[model samples]
Target: MTQISINGVQRQVDADPDTPLLWVLRDELQLTGTKYGCGAGLCGACTVHIDGQATRSCLTPVSAVGARKVTTIEAVDQGQSARVGQAVQAAWVKLDVAQCGYCQSGQIMSAVTLLSRNRKPTDADIDAAMGGNICRCATYVRIRAAIHEAAKALA
Candidate 1:
């Protein structure tokens, strides 16, 4: 059994050390907010915050998490004291950024991470930060607008 701190709670997950953190979260912990798109980590569908940084849970092993705090989409709005995540979530809703809604969680995670560090990101910066997250609906235009809106709200 390995202990992982998830969403401000410590959980004891019983699985192989090599098991992906995504399965550990969804299967063992029942935190299904993190979706599995391409297990190769190229799709960014399994993005989560590990120690306040965006991390791909599908490619990350359970043993690698150690004492790091993992934050999923379910807790992103409530986890941050600065309300950056909440602002991003609000912008996403306001802009109707989700089409199929399958990849929105990952997109929001990446956006929150981006805005947390850079209060005002340029279009290029937004593209660079969000490039990994793929939305089959191709909502890139709205996603970009929401990011800008979130930045404005944060400002």
Candidate 2:
């Protein structure tokens, strides 16, 4: 059994060590906010935070996350990333960023992590952090603009 803290709650997950965390969150905890994109860790769709660092939940195992904070988008926007999500969501609304909205969760997760790390990120910095996140609707321009707008809001 692997012990994990998810969204401030502690739970013991009994599963294979190699079982992907995405399944654990969705199946066991029923937190569906964290999506499953590529399942290969290439896409950022399964992004979640482990100890405040953005990590791909699809490629991560339950055993690997022992005794660490596993925050999904459900809690992210509600607890820790509320203000950040607000700023980003406001910018997203202003910029009309969502098209299909399938990938927005991952995009927002990456953006929030970036904003948390660098309060003021240049275009290149944003690009570097957001490069792996693929938006099928191709909302890169609006996403970038929203990040800048969120930074402005933070400032």
Candidate 3:
């Protein structure tokens, strides 16, 4: 058994030390909000905060987490950067950004992180920061627009 603090609570999960945190979070803990895209970490769908940094959970082993703070979208919505997320979510609803809605969570996660770090991110910054996330529906235009809208509100 290994102990990991998810969001804020400490929980012990019985699994391989090499098991990816993504599996531990979704399978054992049943936090399905984090999605699996490319298991290799190319996609940002599994992005979560590890010790306050956005990390790709798909490539991170549970054993490596140690005492780091892990925050997902569920808890990120209430985090210090939550207002940015709320603004982004609102903009998403207003712009109808989600095509299939599968990638929106990851997109929102990345956006919240970006907005948290860069209060006024430029188009290049948004592109560079959000480049890892893939939206199969090709909703990039609306996504960018929504980010701009959300940034306006957040700023």
- Residue pairs with colliding backbones in model 1 are none
RMSD of 1: 0.9
User: Best candidate per TM-score, number?
Assistant: 1
**Clash pairs of candidate 2?**
none
**Whole-model Cα lDDT of every candidate shown, in order:** 0.93, 0.88, 0.87
Give the local distance difference test score of model 1. 0.93
Q: Write the per-residue lDDT of candidate 2 for residues 58-118, one digit (tens) a residue.
A: 9999989988888888877656777886787788888999998888878888998999888
Candidate 3 lDDT for residue 10:
91
**How many angstroms is residue 155 displaced in model 1 relative to the true structure, after the best TM-score fit?**
0.4
Estimate TM-scores for all models: 0.98, 0.93, 0.94
Candidate 2's displacement at residue 128, Å, is: 0.3
Over the stretch 70-128, how does candidate 3's per-residue lDDT look in tens digits?
Answer: 88878876666668768878899999999898877788888888888888888999999
Q: Per-residue CA lDDT of candidate 1, range 88-121, in tens?
A: 9999999999999999999999999999999999
Worst 10 residues of 2 by lDDT: 76-85
Q: Which candidate, 2 or 3, would have the higher lDDT against the true structure?
A: 2
Candidate 3 runs further than 4 Å off? none
Candidate 2 residues lying further than 4 Å off, grouped into runs, are none
